[model samples]
Target chain A: MSGPAYTPTDEELAHLQKLSSEFEPEVTGPLVGERQSSSAITTEYANADPVYRVKTAALPSKYSHYRTCRGDGHCGWRAIAFTYFEALLRLGDRNRFLEEETRLRSMGNLLNSIGFQEHLYEDFADECFDLLRKTESLVSAGNDERAAAELLASFNDVGVSMAIITYFKLLTSAWIQTHPNDFAPFLDLGQDIRQYCSTQIEPSVCEIDHVGMSALAEVLVKQAGFALEVLYLDRSAGEEINTYRFDPVSNDGLPLHNPPTLRLLYRPGHYDILYKMEDVQQPAIPQAPLHVALADYADEFVPMPTSRGMSDVMSLIPGMYPTGLGQNWPSVSYDYNPSPIPQPQMAAVPTYTSVPVPTTSQEYVNTAHHNVPLESPVGMSLNPPMTIERGGPFRPSMYELEPGFQSNHSQSLPFQTSIFRNSHYNTAHFLNPDFQPEEWSPDSEYVTGSRSRHKSASQ
Target chain B: MSSSRSQTPTKRLLNELQTYQSDPNDALVELGPVSDNELTHWTAVMKGVPGTAYEGGRWKLDIRIPSNYPNAPPEVKFVTRICHPNVNFKTGEICLDLLKTSWSPAYTITTTLTSIQQLLTSAEPDSPLNVDIAQLFRLGDFVGAEALIRYYTESERWEGRQSV
Candidate 1:
């Protein structure tokens, strides 16, 4: 059957006009934008039809607010793609951010393996990557708000927005082929997977079905570590859209708190962003999981193996490993050697005093490759030669070293510096510019030692 | 396609134009906007394949890209006469899946024209726009089909010059 007749009568047109006038402006730009409180929807339906009344009444508690999209056939894809990029921006961590960029670039291989010609989809992928790189550079320059504004602008820009949407379609198509077993059973028309993708999924204006949504969720969850929650709002006999969460991973496998999970609202033919109204008023992001909310690589705090890795040897011989130096630990010495420390003498050395080793930036670079110099007494003892008492609070003069530390690293490893120059703790500590140099050193040393001790014990 | 029409045709058409210019296809096909200033209306001239019954034939097609463009496939009609199972003899309408429900934004004008060229070489008799021509091709009557196709092309060439 060809379904209903194509013609729309005068009565039907009038009905459509009346219905549209009841709502605000129809979405005309990006898939989703302009967030409004749940009250906006609910209040409009207060004296209206039973269907909208029921739908809006259920929205408040579950979904505090909604961001409407353009309602174009590509709304589902646009909604999800925009949210994905927004989530990455919120993450603020350069390492994970760059890691995601590399992963996204590699997804094109999946498109190639599925017999898709490069010309059809390469430009879209290139455009998407270009925006990501541009946003990353802006973010690295410490213009976070500007980076965010630029991202929003790109979503509305004609060329970049559609390219990103097309890229999403290609991603879904590739996903269908690589994991046919997962989606084949769900195909309703007895259509071959490729035929279904080309006909229903690849084309613009084709609304997402269960298979499309699941395939997208699978790729996102597995490749990008994103956990998505979709709430379906429809004409069913319910007060609200049914909520479905797609985690597919336990907390143990993810970063500290699993990047702030993305929430979206799916109304039969379209998708929109959902927000917890309560989260908006809070101080931007303190309650948010640090891994996603802050941009600094959590590598500084991530504990190393106590027995096998160099961190283990560094733990045993404290003076050799530059602990509490923050991101300044030369990547070569710490990252180069993963094998366990073989020498018994090195392993037997208990933790040494936390002493401030003042060295020129050149000295740090010179000693980066030589482990022998690190073990020498010249490296252990410094200019003032102050000995930090063990098992008690040891505060090294952080205030005095802060100026030198900043200049030293930026000069030695210019390219390695990130927008987040210091670890979160250092940023908070340094906020108090009046923190006396005498008191700051010993206290921070004790805190650093206790933290390392805690890490070793946990391991 | 109509209710949720997107505003992407002109931009997409410009992109396709750039691509065609940067990497011109083999001499078999040529396509561009009907007028330099009007991007929505395009014209394509494609050469028939060498080893086929339609060999040495050149076909002109009027390509109208709706304001909605890629979202709704371009409307293609043969301006030159051709005898094929899947192409309408009366209205010059095409019966190709890429121009119908299988249409994807991924398909450019070049790809669509290429598909039409392929149709000339190999027509699917199962779903034909012209039933009688489809039956002739289906019965494997190459001699009869070739004679009719040649007659149509010859007359089309004669009319083509007169109109010009």
Candidate 2:
């Protein structure tokens, strides 16, 4: 967006490319496009991920237990690496780092509690130490009086990779350790946040697997936070990753039986989540409705992209996709299934006022039964009225309501069928006056929303 | 652990697991073990509900029950190539809440099976497990709809045919 588009020089691109995970294609060829003075950028690894500040509830959330979700039974495993890359960006936001550290500690605690043995994670932890120390050194030097900063910058690429790799190792190792019996079954399971594997495995085994996953998720959040820190240093962090999403990681890159397959990144303040499916090379940026731009900004950082591919991009440009959403670096908290409530099947579908209704004239059971409801020069208006639908080129505006027929319309959000649940009778507001029963019934008030209100009020 | 124990899922099913079985008396549907030795695993045949496109169709499922019995619910996945909103694209990972966190202890294997049958009968393409089906339904492609119906109703599905 700054001036004419500028392509990085070959040497610079190569240098940046080295930071990427093996899977992310390196931009090393000649610069096809002319370049201009782009914004001064952070070293690729420094801005590899955006730093998130923790935003937790004052009290613990009932569903507060976050998991990395190693599906040992069905063998669907996801590894979360909380990487703190403190090399380039001297993060002025102290609160962000602290929140992340707290999260890391919590993650460590989560792993420990779930009967996971730490021995399995030693490989990952060992590799991460050197990277973190290097990151610290780079941050200490900065644009300093000496060549120390440059030296640290040189080491950042290898160092960040080590940190990320080791962190993944520990995450997967610990997850597997917790799920020993189920571990072998998950050897094929791709590791990453947001991958669902369907294995008709046993319940006890699944519960144990979930606990291990929770532990892994904790670490991943922290690893993501490190990338976020880099983003905080320079807005250029936004430049590296294009809005087009791709897969998260490769199996070899992040260890323990699988790669990070799923990546869900929220635009800052939880506005939208970009779900990156593994194997999908590039995904277009989800265009938000114009109204999305008008929504007030909350001090929230949504989930960042945590797939292997996104992190690979972060390796090159830093503060791009996955890097922007650092784990443990909290912002506004959100729900995993940020999915809107399911539209319940009540007696009446929520009838919105403005959703064009087919005038009674055009109502027909089938396409052949279509009878245009054109008024035959009926009552004259006080003022000369503008022509409504003079059978112009437009086909019939679909507003027909066939009994039991679902309207063929696209909604901005998912509607919840649970709204039709009579089960929520415990609450007075949700309960119907006539059926004040204690039991949760499927036939309840149409989940209270504006559309439902419109349908009831019109009656 | 006893020799007298009916380890045969079909045998135990007809006796001890009677309440948990789908409607076995109806010729349209069948319930028994997919394997001889595995008592926890069962197979089911669901006749496509009438009035829908799949009226004559049949769907097959491989159900694996947990040892915890009634304390937790069993796992049910479609083995046949039936098209529906709640099932996954590549694998049949159903998106029903009852199978996941929304599961209640009171829900029996029979109830869950019935729930799945209902899902098959009334396919809600809006809240879809497979994005493809959702897209097709959204585009109003009823031809794709009938094709899905043919796949389910075919006799091969009843014999536990697997399709890629």
- The prediction achieving the highest DockQ against the true structure is 1
User: Model 2 over residues B22-90: C-alpha lDDT tens digits?
Assistant: 234332376766676777888777776777766766667778876543334578887766667678745
What lDDT does the true structure give each of the candidates? Answer: 0.62, 0.37
Measured over all alpha carbons after superposition, the RMSD of each candidate to the real structure, in angstroms, is: 19.1, 32.5
**How does model 2 score on DockQ?**
0.01
Query: Tens digit of lDDT per residue, candidate 1, span A393-421?
Result: 23333323232443332222224344434
User: What's model 2's TM-score?
Assistant: 0.25
| Angstrom error at residue A345, model 1 | 59
Off by over 4 Å in 1: A1-31, A47-55, A141-144, A237-240, A248-258, A278-459, B1-44, B47-57, B64-75, B84-91, B95-97, B118-164
Candidate number with greatest lDDT: 1
Off by over 4 Å in 2: A1-459, B1-16, B20-28, B160-164
Sorted into a CAPRI-style docking class, model 1 comes out as: incorrect
- What digit string (tens of lDDT, one per residue) describes model 1 on residues B49-110? 77777766777889998766665689898988788889998898998988876788778888
Give the per-residue lDDT of model 2 (tens digit) for A24-77: 333332111111111112122333444211111100111111112112221122
